[model samples]
Target: MQNSPKKEFRNDEALLDIQDRPTFFHWLILSIQHLFTMFGATVLVPLLIGINPSIALFSSGVGTLTYILCTKAKIPAYLGSSFAFVTTMQALMKADGYPAVAQGAISAGLVYVVVSLVISRFGSNWVDRVLPPVVVGPIIIVIGLSLATTAASDAMLNNNHYDLKYFAVAIFTLLITIIFNLYLKGFPSMIPVLLGIICGYLLAVMVGIVDLQSVAAAKWFSLPAFDVMFVNYHFKWYPAAIIGMAPIAFVTMTEHMGHIMVLNKLTKRNFFKDPGLHRTLFGDGLSSVIAGFVGGPPTTSYGENIGVLAMTKVHSVWVLGGAALFAIIFSFVGKISALIHSIPTPVIGGISFLLFGMIASNGLRILVDNHVNYELKRNLVITSVILVIGIGGAYLQLGHFQLTSIALATVFGIILNLILPQKARSEK
Candidate 1:
């Protein structure tokens, strides 16, 4: 596959295209910006599932590098621990332990591999037919909106109770981010999210919300709690575990497509056509397999990083690579990891407030850019159903597996689009 040519932009533009390379200083800061953006969600998945957060950080870095290599550095995306598998993985961890969960992760990766092979053989035409703009737009919207509650909960609530300090910190951080994004020039303009996070963190520190005890207790350096498949844990195939986890791959795959579509719209380049969806899928799948072997949670394209890309207009794969490196390095440095972990929830919530809104706005941009005729009842139905199902906490359960939120909405949207007549009665 040929690499896309680097697009030139003026210094005043402050835009870093996919193939563009920033200066060393700019690169480091930009990369750190992404690190801050993805750290919370990536580590949260493992923490929620009772796994080692450091391992997730390490695997996320490795997984991102794998994805970069597989996509030939053409797609500026980062892979991080996926939240979609949290419930199933938690159950697997309880029932069959980490071994079964690892096997299940590998099984899920294989499902992506299988799907990628099919797409490679048959091309992605069917994918287009299955997920048109009408369906994809709202799915993207749902993906962002679905996370709204999480953001709000983090910003406004502490242990499910209202916290004035958290609310103030969150609002203050968000305002700082907005001001930077709107009024800054050149380099500062591109890093509003990072700046907001820093200022918010300081505010959190002043408010006594920042806990540094963990950092003080942490060692300077340490190895991640690795659980190598063959070395640390014996490989065991549990059909029930595989059955429980494998189907979730389909769910994440749809989310992956939505992320890719978001990137396409943001970058104005068709990555699916360039690096080929097959390559992207292979990278993502292989990353998950590697994560499984190493005891990290399953990895997928991260929307937080995507939101940073959108906000900063920095799409350099090199910058993303640098973030991956930091993740790996942080995984080994106990104090550093502890310090990052100590960042108050409100700070993260504050950053997410802007980032998630950017994602939702991009979805709206898709609808507008594609000129989707909302006047048509067919289009209206597809969009409406996706939004309701995706944001309303709707879910579908089959035996041991459950499909919920954005994934369920995507499936329903696709089905509705296919069944509904293309030409429908328009509103008067």
Candidate 2:
């Protein structure tokens, strides 16, 4: 049997890690690579939630910068629009409109800040102890699987009718993306997503599925409308909105932990111990609060960018800083923003099919890599329960607020892990 990856480090470590000092040009190129890696996901959130894509891009850049500064430039993670808040954002928008939703997002962010304080006081070992592989693996799985239907639904335009045009586009995009990722070499292979998108978009344009009017009508340069929070600011607190959104933070916090854990494994460094989880959580929370105030979606440390780091093996904080700068620049350029919005849904669906599935794959990889024995009944029971609860969209209501399946499953996993027999846990 393979040894647990939790105790293993890379045999061949990068001579020049993210902290290594590099030339300006080298850092710039690496940063741009990181930006391209996260570009698709950064914009997808706003597109789904009826927010301006420019605002999301801008907020991501600023939020990421905020994260970098908060962690004292020790961690190299990018803050991007979070998909976990989609359902709640939509519901809050319908209930009290976008303004209340924004405030609620800020409230949700404060939850992270509160949790960070708690961790700082008690240390991160408590957290890891409560959420071991048996618990976290299933939560990560649920995060990806819960979004599967949404990805497919968006690709098919949520219509009951199945259009071959979209199906063809999705298939072509997915196939080409996989092909490029596996067969290509050098820089071309590094950016399969950008290439796949271009191919799918060209096909979409030729098939008359794309609308060019938006791109043509958009100005060459203009300031993004920050109206979601600034112009639409109405500060009367809504208990339901705040209560509804805040609890979801607990759900995404697990995701934050997963991101840190994966990076630690990939880089063969204990970031959770070095920079500490408290500081990372503070950065993440601050980014979300800033995003809320700026009319952007809640931001989280992007898993896509983590994949980029593993592939490239260049781990410089400056690289993330450079990517954040480019994202900010993209937000100010109106034509660029419009161009992003003009990409066909089918094209995105093709990529989402791959991206979301990879997330689930990574979750399972966590179990296998860690040598987590499914043969143990305790491990099997915990994983099975969390997956069924989260994937099945089970909910628990607290007054006007509804805790999502992810949130419920997360709470249950932590509770189960704590209460399960110590002897059974140790024997496994």
Candidate 3:
């Protein structure tokens, strides 16, 4: 009798075979691309919530490095600033009535630590069994839809009437990104995000929207004003942070599993069976916790870098390590970073359109993976209600801490999914 077929791989080692690494040039090229992919995201957290960019960069670089080390560089992924925590941090600051919310935000990092421990000990599957698709999906959808304010503002930058140039830039940049990511080819296929930004920057320059004088004035080397770890504790802020940011991890946890599955498919090895998913997730959670401590924002599993791997077909971990090293170097060179910061608004907006939309799509993807059919009365009601309430700002106040429509909806979905009968799945 024929033996059961063994999974074929690109190499016998696939990802595990890191003994033969990418050449220096290969590392350099991949690092450059990785930097571009992660660059905007790293700076994005601080930029949105009024934190120092330099420190954010430094923290992101360090956090990403930590994740790489924890995972033993088994996965070819890039960790970036997570937007999920931005609102939580802002809410913490406002709720605390503190000078800066960074202190309480620091405390929130401990939540990630606790979560990592749970995942590492018991396993990551429970995260989903508890959160479920109904809850995690809609909450993710709301997070994306909630960005409409900024998305619209980005499009406004393209037009001067009422100075909506910001919004216009965003729309234009987004369009280019979609076209490239979905259709463009050759070198353009790999760096679609970068290309969109370049095009938008040029357009903005044509319209005199760019201010290079600031970039020119920025020194070659200088520490960012606020780029260190400091802790602040507000009991009220802690709960808000946990409620708002923790639920989002439900989606990311699944994403981490999916990524590991993909890496398994690519390498033809079961990662979870050996070094393990729990270990990787522990790294992911710790990476975010570290970033928050240094005011960098939360870190998350990145699908974009995965796309790069698919495009380039280069499975060398050295490339990922190279990217981190480059980011560390850039953290100190104020001038080079200043140039990156000089890129125009429209480009960012354009890229954000696709990036943000893809994020929303990921949430929906989770539901699809679960075969989430709304035929069941419970599923139908929970899903429909969540969509409307979260998108419509269905929120509740819990004393000093206000629960966002998304967070409230998340909790409600979890409870409903728990009690709901799965018998309906077989009905149709």
Candidate 4:
């Protein structure tokens, strides 16, 4: 339960191990920090898809707890609303309705359960052999780069012309984040993203850009609305929805691995080797299913939470438990949810710019750390193909099902790796 001797302490003199549980006050403070780190991105899934934010928050808390239990309290991750299902869910809802989309997510979660069982029975060697650093690195890069346009759009606020106001807020936030990360020390340095957000939010208010009228009118307490549940809708068991949703799970599983890899690096713990990939994947899938049943968006490990782990150096499962509890409590408080939604887009844009870039950088770091040789022809081919197909928006459509760039790259890399022969010198 304690930290490994190989743990990299942020401060050489002050080491905080996983087992070195903090006081109640300290735990609360750290947990609140985790809350802020995840809150900005977690609610966006429901916000974009026109679902109740309270339900998303509540489900995220429950989902995270479910993951923790499934992993035997070993993995420190917060499962929240996934962005992967955004477009597909929208299309399904428009075509078939919300009930159909919910059914699709449930089907996808079932697919994860099957994949997890396979890994659990046969072990992760098959996965590692097929999707090693060479393959996983570019896939992770694609996960971040694919979202580049969305990040830029949020920051720029204009596709054709420059909007100096929003752009300046983004830059200001970015600058403060850099300063907090590099120049500052102690607590402030650990929560640079949170600090940057506070600064940007204040600036946004000064410029008269923030709108808090909704917060002012919102009730103090409210329950989640479950009117869109699959059971509530007529004919929710459409075969087409299940067919379309099941394949999306394959893509998400790849992203799940990347998230686990990043967590491994951040905490200096080989979670895949410890709790094992089978358990982690099972937990993730179960969380997704749990979210779907509650009328929330499908859940996945939050990359923003991983970023928080990397920055804060606080790797305690109890802290995550506290965050989950806070989320659950906040879900019932209508005003709190409104306040979270009121945070201007520019602030989120500025923070996401740094957070998403860090994710891509970590992917590259994985390559270097693992000694993935670019000199080998097979390696070069694998890397180039994955990066291009993943970032280029290439799609593999089968009937109504489709695999996006990351999923395609993962499949292609595994196939290419297994088939390509190892050669020496010039041939390599």
Leading candidate by lDDT: 1
lDDT of 3 at 85: 58
lDDT of 1 by residue, 1-428 (tens): 12345344222232877777888888889999999889988999988888999999999999999999999998899999998889889888888888888888998999999999988998976777887889888988998999999899999998899999999999999999999999999888888988999999999999899988989999999998798899986555788779889998998998999999998888887778878999999999999999999998899999999999889988889899999999999999999999888988999998888889899999999899889997788998899999999999898888778887788899899899989987755544
Q: What is each predicted model's overall lDDT from 0 to 1? A: 0.89, 0.78, 0.62, 0.79
| C-alpha-based local distance difference test score of model 1 | 0.89
lDDT at 341, model 2: 68
TM-score of each: 0.96, 0.84, 0.71, 0.90
The prediction achieving the highest TM-score against the true structure is 1
* Cα lDDT of model 3 by residue, 117-177, tens digit: 7757777555547656666666566555655555555556445454666656666777766
lDDT of 4 by residue, 232-340 (tens): 7665467877877788888888889888877776666677777899899888888878777778888989877776666667777888888999999999998987887
| lDDT, model 3, position 328 | 75
- In model 4, which runs have C-alpha deviations exceeding 4 angstroms? 1-20, 158-162, 227-236
3 or 4: which has the higher TM-score? 4
